[model samples]
Target: MKWQLAGSLGLLLALALVNVQVDVKGYTRSLATRVLGALTSPTSHFTDLETSETSDDEDAEISDTSETENSDTSETESLETSESEDLETSETESSEMSETEVSESGVYNYEGTEPLDLTQKLMDSANKKEEVRNTAGSEYCLSEDDDPYTGFATMTPYRIASTPLKADDVIPAGCKPVQIWHLIRHGSHGAHRNDYIKFEDELPHLRRRIFRARVHWKGQLCEKDLELIKLWKVSKMMSKTGNLSKEGVEEIAGLASRFKSVFPGLLEKKFSIKRHPGDGNKIAFGTGSQNHQSAVAYISRMYDAYARYVPVGSQPSKTLQFYDYCRNYIEGVLNMDKKLKPYHTFMSGGIMNSVLQSVSERLGFPVTVANVRVMYNACRYYYAWYRNKVSPWCTVFTPKQLKVLEYWEDLRVYHDQGHRFEINSKQACVLGKDLMDQFRNRVENGNTELYAASYFVNPEALVTFITLLGLFNDEEPLNEFYVPKTRMWKTSQFAGFGSNLAIMLSSCVDDSFWVSALLNEKPVQLPGCDSSLGCPWNSFIQYYDYLSDCNFDELCGSFSSQLAQSRHWYASYMNEQWM
Candidate 1:
């Protein structure tokens, strides 16, 4: 008896040890979660209350990296992008407690720091990071030692970059999940033709400057990193500029797999319904091919059948892609000086100036802010596309610097796609109407043919949808004034590529239906969603009820324009007149 008791105690102690939590990539989690994951197969009978399974899915996410266009209008993109307006990455999350009403109040991480002295002696010492590994030609990935992902807006690899949900946070108990509605953006795509051009054309001159410059950079950058930078070769993938990368296909595949595992009943093959372009070519640059490929990659993996799906066209309907028809916005942003003023102001602020000066001094060259921006672009795009690899350019910044850059990207997105204008959010009501309709069907009729509806669109539409639904509304609007580090509108988490907003309908024993919101696989409470029971079915439906018969022209005040932003797949590529 004593022997048995001793063994039991030993086992209990071991379990306790296993339960101790550890922090990973800015997220706090218990090792017990891993222990549970080890014991559970995601494919096994899924319960609405439990899904604590982990795969070699190295993602805090499931992230690992991170766009395009083709049109007659003369293309003129620069370091300052029109946000994700032209980003073509197959790219772009978080777990529990992800949304916290950030539009009004939150702590911004940035402050005006003293400018770096151009004459100050350069140095690289103990402050230089100890880790240095060049992953240019390697397939290596998911190092626990790697720094937490610094979100890079739409360029972010959604899953691999964000933390996962606590298993139990999926759905509340006594709630039987009946259906799922998912709105997904395309996965991390290839670099823009412009960025690719700059990487090939402009970066070499900067590299030569670094190589020939006379100064001490050893203190800021380790020798190995510097060497790797010097030896850096532009990726051959750049040749396929403005299309989805292979990594992007993998992201969609992984998402499809995990979604099924998390809600097996809702996502089963018989219940699955996918609506996206059927083109096999990987779309970017207004081709529906990339979007189609994304849907194929997702559905094929989910059902284990590629040929089952027939061909379809891209989602060019003005309802979801309404930005094309909105004349005020299309014309307003045309004035680069006026449209990008807030972003440009932030970019040229004292804080940004400090960052530019510091990076230039570190490399011992006359690097411009544009150069730093490009280096940042290289780091995010490369890391996003090659989840298993780190970029040599990634070594350029310290953690603090990464945060500053992240905020910079966020500020740009804030104005372009976020709460800057109610018009943007108003345009999203069409999507909101579609989502609530699914839940309403299950509630009113009581489980009519199991439903899993997945729609794919670009980030421009996705962000507007998020805005309309008030998913990440912050207390303070993002501006050149400061960085809201604690805010919910952080695009890296809110709008990453492959990012999704899932609204699930669960039926209760009490004869009521409730809906739960999951943003990029993490549980989040939408404006008035219950902390536990999620949101009541009626409440969910009422929010979008106003869109019963909404019209895009009426919403935008019958606006019309001939200016082609080349942002709309249908309007730009297919020759749809917005008027």
Candidate 2:
């Protein structure tokens, strides 16, 4: 073993003395040096061998260090030479990114340095449409040109406010408008099912009679008059049955835009156009389809976008047709067609019959009372549909005949919807209480987020509610108007298409909340109110306290039973005196 070990040691020493070339992916020195050092020092002490091996490893590491340093030096010089090019490329990329950002941000820096006249562009577009000039010559035919109540209950489109409210007019002295409660009636719609049916039944016969009359009075009936009679068609009118006309949609949209413009501070930011999930702003619409459509159009115009806030549709029992659920109203007013018997009898009697005959003679036709009613309806509808243009049918009746017809129409509305019975006004109590509750809640939490509250309803509901509000100013006047004596409660003022009643809650200088009422966009004073700014909040609350406790479900149930039990309910109601 000693001889073999000596021989191996000699071989290793020979290898170590001579330089051995080993290719180890260019790392050739470390392994060869370690082996050579270990073998060449075999006879030396183990500590000496370890020291020699460590020395060899250190020398190999030094050589590697020198190569790495040279490579690093070359890399540093190359990076320094390309630095300016790299910086230029970065700057170009950054400039391109900035331009992209500016384009995305929609900020246009004009070369001319002149601001764009957006308002003038809008005016030019409007002028191109020629809406005002076109509307100028479109005047509705009326018995009297001076008559302000031309539209009556079938509301014609008209301007609500000529000018917008100034800042002082809305905000008032030290008072800030916290909450706005608006009850808007749906826009102008076509006749109901019953009225449409009546028109269909009577129009064909009336048209035939007019044709015969045209032949009877050859020269007296002008070509225009004959053409008007020929143009009268039931199908065109029936197409819009119980739905809002295009003009009606326009009317509602215009009204909403006007309201937004008038109260920008209340409606701008931090306000919701419709009811949202969180408790902030609430806008409600009645369950009626017409009301919903009106709400959509109004919101679209108000926001200048598709309506974002989903509207809360009030229950029909609670808001839309509340009168139908009211026990007293359904039993006493709606079922009581007999109470209006006197007015109906008088209207169908010799006085009105003579007026009808006179109208027929003027038209050179033998016209019945039914035909005359149809003609009057045509006058009203055509006037409204034409967007305030007078219908040719209006020329058929003289001014005196129109007055008689107006009075007869008033009687019908008075008995059915007006103050003929106590229940008519009381039916509005439920809605009144709702308004009061909203106002009270906002007033109690004046610092809270509840800013605007809106309600949409039908025209009939609005009329009844306004009547309950004592809009006529005197009960005696209401009675006199019911007697077919005067036109105190004009339908144009109370229940027109897109009609609105706004109750503004303003904080006063004395730290009290004041309530103001605006009817059809015209400021009006309540009974106790001295000015148009309206009465105290307490008084407003007191005026509607009776309705606060009304149980809608109970009232509806009671009325349903009463209507079921009485076979002669209509007859019984007619006998009862007007309250």
| Candidate-wise lDDT, in order | 0.59, 0.59
Which pairs clash (backbone N, Cα, C closer than 3 Å) in model 2? 139-389, 139-390, 140-388, 140-389, 140-390, 141-390, 339-574
- Runs with alpha carbons beyond 4 Å of true place in candidate 1: 1-145, 165-168, 214-219, 270-288, 310-318, 333-340, 445-450, 542-549, 557-579
Positional deviation of residue 132's Cα in model 1 after best superposition, in angstroms:
21
**Candidate 2 displacement at residue 282 in angstroms:** 2.8
Error of 2 at 55 (Å): 99
TM-score of each: 0.67, 0.65
Clashes of each: 47, 7
User: For model 1, how does the per-residue alpha-carbon lDDT over 271-359 read when each residue is reduced to its tens digit?
Assistant: 23443322221222123555667877776777675436534345544555667767666555423354355777776788888887767
**Over the stretch 428-450, how does candidate 2's per-residue lDDT look in tens digits?**
77777877777877777655567
